[model samples]
Target: MKIATYNVNGVNGRLPVLLRWLAEAQPDVVCLQELKAPDDKFPEQAIREAGYQAIWHGQKSWNGVAILSRIGAIHETMRGLPDDPTDQQSRYIEAAVNGILIAALYLPNGNPKPGPKFDYKLRWFDRLIDHAETLATSGLPAILAGDFNVVPTERDVYKPERWMDDALFAPEARAAYFRLLEQGWTDALRTCHPTETIYTFWDYFRNAYGRNAGLRLDHILLSPALAERLKEAQVDAQVRGWEKTSDHAPVWVRLRN
Candidate 1:
């Protein structure tokens, strides 16, 4: 099974690029982030025509998440993060497809740190870590995939020093990311190519893509049951060069069924 994750930036605006990638890559399951559309606005018909069924939690103009599966019906498990019913960002969604449980998440970016947004990002990470502990021990075939919004390590970004002041590479955020790893969820891509410089996102500024300046923000994490099945992990970086494409490229993992 080919399981993939991508942050489309805006589902409607980039529908063409998305459809093109879907036809070319044909992943069995896909976790999409940043729909930037309300539930009613989701282009379900177009997605259906592409041979996938989807369940999405969408907000009007900002954060949104969705899961797409061509392998089987999506038995939705969760729509948003637990522990805060009042917090209403469409950032997390989970479902069961093809016998495996998948959690699709769009973690807070927490930009311009030393402020409220950064605080929220930390709190959110704590919640994710708590819930992830349960899933870690459940022993279910599970995958946590999407844009985590963390640079993770010095090796993940093009220039570590230049990003030290940025929230994505902040020590606190990176520490929280490591805490998730401590729960036994294997970082599939890093595990597959430990020393390789793999990047999934490139900003629109300064000709970043052309200069090969990028960050590995999107990730696919596998639980113990499915970790052993991981065969290969890759980024369709060329997709980022497509006309009107997202800053993020599709990242996928091939698993033995």
Candidate 2:
């Protein structure tokens, strides 16, 4: 089975690009982030016509997540992260599809750091860490896939010096990511292609994509059981060059069924 994750940026605005990619890639399971639309505004009909069934949690103009499955029924398990009653952002959704538990998430960007937004980002990371620990021991094949909004390490970014102070590359953020990995989740892409300069997101400004100036922000982490089945992992970097495409390209993993 092929599982993929992409930050569509805006589902409706980029439906064409998305649909075209779906036809070309044909992943069995897909996790999408940054819908940037209200629940009623999601293009359910269009997506359905593309040969997939989906469940999405959408908010107005920002922060949404969804899971699409073409291989089997998607049984939704959760819509939002637990232990955050006051937090209303539509950043998380979980479902069971094709015998694997999938969690799709859109971690906060937290730009212009050293402020409230950055604080929220760290707090959210803490919450995710707490939950990931439980998932690690659930004994089910699972994947945590989405735009993590993190650079993770120097090798994960194009220019480490230029991003040292950025929220995505901050020491605290990177440390949190490492701590999460300690919970027994494998970073599929990195595990598959360690030492390679792989990237999934490129900024639109300064001809970043043309220059290969990018960051590996989107990720698919596999639990031990799922990691054992990992056969291949790659980034569809060319997708970032498509007209009116998102800053993020699609990243996928092929698992032995």
Candidate 3:
């Protein structure tokens, strides 16, 4: 089965392109981040017409997540990260598709370091770490996939020096990401192509896409059971060049069932 993740940027604006990719890639399960639409605006009929059923957690204009499954599967859309008493972002959703438990996430951007937003980013990562631990103990094959908004290494970005102060490449952000990986989860892209400069997201400004300047912010982290069956992993870079495309492309993995 193939499972993929994409940050469509905005559900309504990118609907056509997303549907095109869904038709072409044909992943059994697709997780999305940054839907940037309200719950009532998710276009459920459009997705269903494209042959996929979806469950989404949405908020207005900022963050949202969804899971699309080809075959009917057990799905759960949780409200917020555990242990956050006041957190109210629609950034996570989990579901069971063909016996695999999966979560789609959109970690906060938290730009302009040394500020409250950056602090929130770290706190959110901490929450994710705690959630990951529980998933680890669940003993079922599970995957955490989405636009993490993080760049784990210099190789994961276009220019190390250029991105130092950016939220995605900050040492603190990278360190937290590493901690998550240490909790027995495998970064599927690196597992399959560790040495390659595999990137899943490119900025829309400064001709970034045309120049091929990008980052591997989108990812699929799998539990041991799922990692053991991992057969292939890749980014569908061509999708970035599609008409009215999102700045981010789809990253996916194929695994033996």
Candidate 4:
């Protein structure tokens, strides 16, 4: 099976680009982030036409997440993070499709550090890690895929020094990301191409995409059972050149039978 993760930026705004990519790539499962639409506003018809069934969690104009599968319609698994009752962001959604559990997440983009937002980001990470521990004990094969919004290593971004002050590259963010991997979840892309410098996202500013300046914030992480099945991982860099496209491109990985 082939699974892909993409932060579409806005489902409505990038519908055309998404459709084209879907037709061309045809991943068996897709975890989409940042739909930027209300629950009622999701374009179900368009997604259905492409031969996939989806379950989405949406909020007005900010964060949203969804899972799409051609193998089977997603069976509700979980929704939202468990720790914070007051957390109102629609950033977490999980479903089961074809016996494989998938978690689609849009982690908080904690900008302007040394402030409330950054604090929230760290707190959110703690909750996610706790939830992940619970999932680990299930023994069912799973894949956690999404735009984590955190760069795990220096090699992940184009200019590490320039981004040291940024939320995505902050020490706390990197440590939290490392903690997730240390818990035995396999970073599929890195597992496939251990030494390669692969990237999944580019900033819209300063002609970043034009110069191959990007970050590998989007990822597909697998449980131990699923980890053994990872076949190949790839980033569709070409997609960034599409008309009115998102700053991020699709990141995908294939699995064995």
For every model shown, what is its TM-score relative to the native structure?
Answer: 0.99, 0.99, 0.98, 0.98
* Per-residue accuracy of model 2 over 117-201 as CA lDDT, tens digit each: 9999999999998988888998889999999999998999998999987999999999999998999999999999999999999
Going through the candidates in the order shown, the clash numbers are 0, 0, 0, 0
Winner on lDDT between 2 and 3 is 2
Please list the residue runs of candidate 3 whose C-alpha ends up more than 4 Å from where it truly belongs after superposition: none
Clashing pairs in model 1?
none
Question: Can you write out model 3's per-residue Cα lDDT over 1-257, one digit (the tens) per residue?
Answer: 99999999998999999999999999999999999999999999999999999999999998999999997764684656888778888998898888899899999998988899999999999999999988877788999999999999999999889998899999999999999888889999999997998889888899888888998899899997678999999999999989889989999999997
- Provide the global lDDT of candidate 3 against the true structure: 0.91
lDDT of 1 by residue, 1-257 (tens): 99999999999999999999999999999999999999999999999999999999999999999999998999999888899988988999999998999999999999879899999999999999998888889999999999999998888999888998999999999999999998899999999989998899999999999998999999999998789999999999999999999999999999997
Worst 10 residues of 1 by lDDT: 127-136
Q: After superposition, how far is residue 63 of candidate 3 from its true place, in Å?
A: 0.6
- The TM-score obtained by model 3 is 0.98
lDDT of each: 0.95, 0.95, 0.91, 0.92
At residue 64, give the lDDT of candidate 3. Answer: 95
